[model samples]
Target: MIDDFLDGSLPAVEEAVRKAAAAEIMPRWRQLATHEIVEKSGPHDLVTVADRLAEAHLTVSLTALLPGSVVVGEESVHADPAVYAALRGDAPVWIVDPVDGTRQFVRGEPGFCTLVALAVRGEVLASWTFAPALDEMAVAVRGRGARLNGTAIRAGSPARGAVLKVAMSHPDYTTPEEKAALLCLDTEGVEARPCGSAGLEYLAVARGALDAVAFSWEYAWDHAAGLLLVEEAGGAHATLAGVPFRVTGANVLPFTAARDQATATRIRTLLTAP
Candidate 1:
């Protein structure tokens, strides 16, 4: 299926994502009226008309490009949580987060992006992360490596013997144990701060801007594309339990992605340490 995707539908998928972003997302950036934005669960959790329209557009175009494929979009799942069940099904599934960082997007921030990943059962095979505001696009194929814009790039190595810089989940969103573990990064000679979008954090790790990212949530739409990007760029992501992350959303909390396996393991150890 991955081979088929790379050979036949990759371009179409990219086009669908770009089209949805340009048509529904970029146009509304920071231009949304008060009524167009609303809270999902709280003040921090947001949804916008752009997110809905983009997901709707991608769902139709993507499903058409791959006849039997199903879509598990963020907005769609918010409307019907059952839509996520497709990720566990036998068919190829398109996990879409039309506007990945809704809060950032609402604030006219550049960290928000459009995230799309193709997964079978529970494993992601290919992924795309498009930060329309930043005019950056990253693509990753299962074994073909990853690309930024159109050029191949490798994840940079961490500086030798320097304090690792990390972006961690905000304390407000983490459990008490998770928060304590996250603070351990500081004691371990790591610089830790709050992360914005999970997608952009992964991009930073892949590009070597930041040493690592520790995230508590495991939503497929948030982590799927970025996980592939990091892995293909010679980076690695794993749960604190020392296992690979699954897009099926059944992983332990506070997973870490870093420039390499060793850095990832080290960050994970710090975050999970007692």
Candidate 2:
């Protein structure tokens, strides 16, 4: 069933994402009221009416598109942590981050996007990343490659001897230990900056606009869509343990998604260095 959907209905899923963004997200951008936005964990972690409503809209539209599928959404998990268990269950799961950069959105910045990925038993099969404000939609299907705005894109390797451009987790979201691993990027041959919008950063890696991304956390909604996009675009991702990242959890911290396997290995080596 899942394969059948991926084989032919990708455009339908993309349209659903665009509709959710247009109906629930874009309307609230730069127009949010004081009462509509609130902190979830701290000042850095935010959730707004747009995020909630968009996720709700996608939940309904997506599940309806593929009957019997479940959703593991950021807002849904925030409301009920148990909902995340669907990722490991037998049902096909839609991992969604309706508003990937709430802070940027609230500030009227155009760096945010909506992310959705279809996964079954821990393997992501397809993904969509839509940046409505920027008028871009990136899609990826397992083994079929990735595309942006209907055109194929690739994550070409960085030039020889060029400094690797890496978008890393912000210090606020990292543990002291994870922070230490990320600090390793500060060495020569790498230019690292705090990430903005995990989805867009992953898109950057997929399209070769950016060299790589180093994230300390592993929320399925945040990484699922982007990781598959990078992979289908010929990029690679690795964790501190020198293995591919696993969306199902228990990955070593400060994982990297790079333009190619060699870059991924180099980043992994840096993360493991003393």
What tens-digit string does per-residue lDDT give for candidate 2 at 1-274? 7778888899899999999999999989999999999998999999999999999999999999999999999999999999988889999999999999899999999999999999999999999999999999999999999999999999999999999999999866689899888888999999999999999999999998899899999999999999999999999999888888888899988899999999999988998885
Winning model by TM-score? 2
* Number of clashes found in candidate 1: 0
C-alpha lDDT of residue 56 in model 2:
96
Model 1 misplaced stretches (Cα beyond 4 Å)? none
Tens-digit per-residue lDDT, 202-244, candidate 1: 9989988889999888889999999999999999989978899
Superposing all C-alpha atoms, what RMSD in Å does each candidate have to the true structure? 1.1, 0.8
- Pairs with backbone N, CA or C atoms under 3 Å apart (clashes), candidate 2: none
Per-residue lDDT value at 213 in model 1: 92
Among all windows of 10 consecutive residues in model 2, the one with the lowest summed lDDT is 170-179
Candidate 1's error at 157, in angstroms?
1.5
Range of the 10 consecutive residues with the lowest summed lDDT in candidate 1: 1-10
In order, what lDDT does every prediction score?
Answer: 0.89, 0.94
